[model samples]
Target: MRIGLLTEGGYPYAAGEPGLWCERLVRGLGQHQFDLYAVGGSGIPRPLPPNARVARTADLGGSDSGPTARNLLERTAFGDRRAARRAYGRRERRRFVEALHRLAVGVCGEHTAGTGEAETGAELGIAFAEGLYALAELARERGGLPGALRSDDAVRTLESACRAPGARRGAAAAGLPDHLAFVEHLERTLRPLSLDWYAEDALGAADLCHAAAGGTTALPGLLAKRFFGTPLLVTEYGVQLRSHYLSAAGADRSAPLRTLLAALHGRLAAEVYGQAALLTPGNAHTRRWQEKCGADRARIRTVHPGMAADRFAEVGEDEESGDPATLVWVGRVEPAKDLIALLHAFAEIRALQPDARLRIVAVPVRDPGSGAYLAHIKGLAAQLFPDEAAGAHAVGENPVTFEELGGPEAPTLEDTYASGAVVVLSSVVEGFPTSLVEAMFCARATVSTDVGAVVEIIGGTGLVVPPRNPRALADACLALLREPERRHRLGAAARARALELFTVEQNLAAFRGIYLELLSHAPVRHRPGDGVPFAHPAEAHVPGSWAPKAAAGTGAPDA
Candidate 1:
């Protein structure tokens, strides 16, 4: 079978998100051929397994134009020509206008009224889907949507919809600049309409289209399914819509613009969830989000992300290795981790057990603000532990040590986990909690805040505390520190659970079955010149119900 693997800012790039898992999947399923279609990020290719190869790669992250000839080709194909603009007939124009109006109404309505307004949300969702498909059809028929979507007509349509009665107050307040900015962003997000991947020679040739994530990455697969009847398998480790909400929450954008963008993303997410044959969320937390966004419960499956457990095997088996009085926190240093709360909790724990140590081993994040956040955390640590030498750690001298993952003290991930008896997760916000699972794989007892999937993953194997509560967090840590027998019991249970459900082999097995099951039920849409089914001599004699049976009197099969 041939698979078209689609991704945005992930896979086939060394620095890509979820790159390792994707690589593992491809390498594990060597029997199947894979054609990768990637968008955004540095287009540098990674070393792929022999069965996998790059089919198409595009960088849509910026506004830079490529070669003149390519630009001309795009302009011509996308109906940038004045003659082509004139070719948009009265009927086509009306359809385009109606589509935009419906979409804008949906966006604006939902923003003013909440999603709990079921009648409005449902009506708006239907309108949004209809408008989206109509636009897709128009783009397909008219060559491209760039010219139409960017035209003054589109902006006017948006403005009129925003100002219309029953529209959200925030949307109605949008100025001309806000409308223009939104239109530009929408065009870029919908750029898949102008891409050539939907052609018969491209995505149409694949047996199945597997989207590694949602949002723009799934856009191509959506188009392929629309045009070619190809089945789409969407797997989301993190909900893109939720990420957008968080990002927009922190962005310095106008209220109207933010509301408009949120509505657009929400509608798009609904459409994607509605169309997908199967929705595999990395955890139940994402599954619930998808359900709220309109994904069918029947189609949703929870596939826990696979992690390599071999590296932590030795530590897991040791049982009595790490210091009994130490607690460790591992992950990227970010505000969401709530390291400040962890410090306060540790201060409380210090009062109870003066000999107890806390180790905060973090990997530096790529965000520019992370440096400042790290400095803030270090300052908090110093203020809390006034007497200890916190700079360069001298092992037992400092009660709290802040170290990087690859530093001389903590050379590797396993080393960090192995240094402490209890792994602590102090995150106020989390998704799947990969570090918590890693600690589980290391056979360490855990104390994590009740955020995201922490409770779901822990499943009574470890202690859970409420987010933003230092006292609760401190109490949980104290429980694990005071009772060695309890820690051992939880650690053993945690490791057993990790081995049973979260290994690479289990993930590969699940996907292998899903691919075969999807392909078996899908209708065959063979391309021209493909070889006849069962043409080989050996294949002709294979045992199956379809094979002809021999008559009782003769060796020859019945005609």
Candidate 2:
């Protein structure tokens, strides 16, 4: 089957979040034909996988690009729907407006488990909520949606939702800056609605539209079903909705804005689950989130993100040979990764074992904000370990060294893993925990803060610590440091588990079956003798809709 694989910021791009996984999927499933459609993150060069035949690509532009919407006329050749929408009488317009209103104001975010729609038959409510909006897209705009979805209406909803009881903590966003931001964000969030991606040429041709992440990516999938009776498979390794909540929590953005955006995302997720043929969350953690989002338990499948095993093959086998005194922390040096906390923990580890030195080897993903954060961590290291500055070996002998991967000093990933007795993660927020998996591949014992998917990924093979607590993090690292035999045992077990469950082979096999499974029960749309796809039925045409019968036979009915 030909697959139109949709992606945002991960695949086909030289640098994307799910790039490796998508590349692996394409390469592994050589039998399938794939037309990759990419939406690239700003400034990042996207490289297509060798197996994928790229159809189209769009730049999400930048963080500052104003709100976007897909204009229907520009995207579709819906011969009759345009007129049908314009001719919608009063009743049609009212129903459409009501659905749009409820959708915009629904109180939920990515984290809100959907109202238990399955047991309660709440899919109807979700359908009513989702269908109304989709129908509105096809619904006669009679007088053009009665002014709903306008800036003024948006302003009012923003006002009401923000002031409503149980508002988010950021509720104080009542000022001008806040209001404008809301308008800006709302438009961008709704951009997918305006796209013609749902049309047969874009998203409809595929057997299933699989969105790599939620939020913007799911929009086209929604439209695909609306236009072509296509099924959708949404796979979210890092819950987009949860990320929104976390980002909003610390954001200085506005309370009303957060509330409104959260509601919008929540409703969209519900609508997605309400309509999707299947939902695959990367792990049980994401699975639970989908279930709570009102997805049918039956439809929810836990498909672990596929990680290439090659990176870890060498590290996995030689688990016992890495340095006993050096503890390696490899990843981007971001504030969230909490390297500062790791540094302090290392200071304490030094107290326990004077020979122990913490080597922070930065893995450069080359993000926009990486420079400043890396610089901040470097400065923090200087203040904490002043003796390591340039040429000063002070009283305590600066025991921590900051370095970057792919540099002169640090060797390859295998070499980096070999140089450490333990791998460490100190992030306060994480998702699906890629670093932990990498460490596990190298069969390196790890001490990580119990955050995000650390515990989930580590399972039982490594020591876990509570986040932000330097003391606990220190204790965990030392436990591994003093007991070499224990580290070796845990490392060996971790490698075996990772190879068995997290490889590209397993991921492809799971999806290969899922694709067939979804296709098995899905309704076949094409009809023989219909000619080109989606051609209007002969009876439904207004006599000579396609051609003049006389030029062939009648000529515009003598008009």
Candidate 3:
């Protein structure tokens, strides 16, 4: 089957977790044809799988020089730029204003007091849908949405909605700066409407549209389902709305601005969840988030992230556990990882087991703040273990060592996981905990803080403690360190569970079924002169069932 795969900042253009998983998915599902619609990223895309090709790519930076509608029109025999511009004149302007007004109002309004939340929510949803589709249609016709959305008129309409009676208090209090900020964000969010992929030869021609993530990436799939009869399958490893909230929480923006933006995202998420044919969240954690944001439980499925376990096979299968007294932590060095707490926890562990060592192995820093955070961690380590600080220069006598993944000490992930007896995760905020899964793949026992999907991923195979609690984290680590037999049993179980559920083969099998299941229920779409296999089956022309008729002499009833 032909699949329209929608993605953003991942897939062909970027090299990261997002791109890796997508590449694996494409390579594994070689039976299906994939047409990728990638958004944003500059460097060369990785080589495409045999069955996959990039259908279109858009820059999220909004650098499109020609609108899709105008370009398509100009290519026609009688089409001209002047005529296209005239098409977006007075009448089109009125339509755009009306649609934008309705959308802004829907986004700005709050639930009524007397009316049940369900009723008011449904009404707002309807309003939002009407405005969103009307705008999409206008973009298809005039291709002026990108320009008009950035115009003064759009800001005025949004302001009027915010100031209207019964608007949410935060929205009513929005200042000029907030209005400008929101308009810019809104333009970027709705930019997908202005793309040329909505035509019959693009998203409309696909057997199914698969959105690789939620939020802006899903906009095209939403439009495809609206404009054509294409079914949309939305898969979200990370909840986009949750990410928006986290980023906004850290921003220096006003409460009113944050409130307005939150409402916009919440409304959009609700729409996407409501319309999706099926919602596949990477884990139960994301499934709950989707449900809270209005996804139907019946339509939701949990699919774990897939990992390549072959690289760690030797480590996992090895019966000998490395240094029984060593505890290792591996991941990126970020504030969220709470390495400070880990350091404190290790201090307690050190007091109990002086000979015990800790390896603080980190991947290369990605965020600008990470380098500073890593430096702070190193400083704290020095302060806690002053004697060890000096011993580091003398020899490898330091109880705590900080090293990068590919450095001299730890040349690879397998070496990092194999070098320690127990794996530790002290993250205060985690999603899926890829490092913990990596430890499991290496057949290493883990002691992780209870955050995000830690408990779920561990599945009773390892110990989990409360986040930010040094005592608890330390105690859990000690329990595993003291019991060699228990650690061996848990590590063996972890490797078995990882192989059963988290391998790439398992992930590919799940999606292969999901794709066929979605297609099976979708209405068959056949166009004229198409080279479809059974487009005009002989039995389809008959009104009744294709049962054999009784013999003419028998006068029997038709079977």
The better-scoring model by TM-score among 1 and 2 is 1
Query: What order do you get sorting by TM-score, best first?
Result: 3, 1, 2
* Residue-level lDDT for 38 in candidate 1: 76
Lowest summed lDDT window (length 10), candidate 3: 72-81
* Per-residue lDDT of candidate 2, residues 1-559 (tens digit): 5566778673565454487777778788765667776655334444545546766565654352332222222212242235434555557645544554454334321222466534333533453366446543743223333223333434455556455553444544455455545545655565555444554566666767777777777766776777677778888898888877876233665455556566666766777776888888888878777788778998888888888779668667875677798888888766788887887887788777878888888887756787888788778777776766655655555567777788876868778887888998899988787878888888999888887767778889998878999999889888888898999999988888888888778889998888778776778666433244433321233433454332345332221
Deviation (Å) of 307 in candidate 1: 0.9
Query: Candidate 2 regions off by >4 Å?
Result: 40-51, 62-99, 107-132, 135-179, 248-250, 365-369, 388-398, 527-559
Give the local distance difference test score of model 1: 0.82
Over 1-559, each residue of candidate 3 has an lDDT whose tens digit, in order, gives 7889997685699887878888999999877779999966566778997889988888877522223433333332133324434557878878988999889888998888875978988888788888998999999987637467656567678999999997899999997767766776788889889998888888987888998888889989999999997899999889889888877233777788888889888988999999999999999989999999889999999989899999999999995958999999999998889999999999999989988899999899667888888889999999989887876543348899999999999999999999999999999887778998999999999999989988889998999999999999999999999999999999999999999889999999999889888887888777643443442242223333322332334453332
Candidate structures ordered by lDDT, highest first: 3, 1, 2
Candidate 1 positional error at 301, Å: 1.3
Worst 10 residues of 2 by lDDT: 68-77
Misplaced by over 4 Å in model 3 are: 62-87, 248-250, 392-396, 535-559
Off by over 4 Å in 1: 14-17, 62-95, 111-119, 141-143, 248-250, 390-396, 534-559
What are the per-model C-alpha RMSD values against the true structure? Answer: 5.7, 9.3, 7.3
Give the top-scoring candidate (lDDT): 3
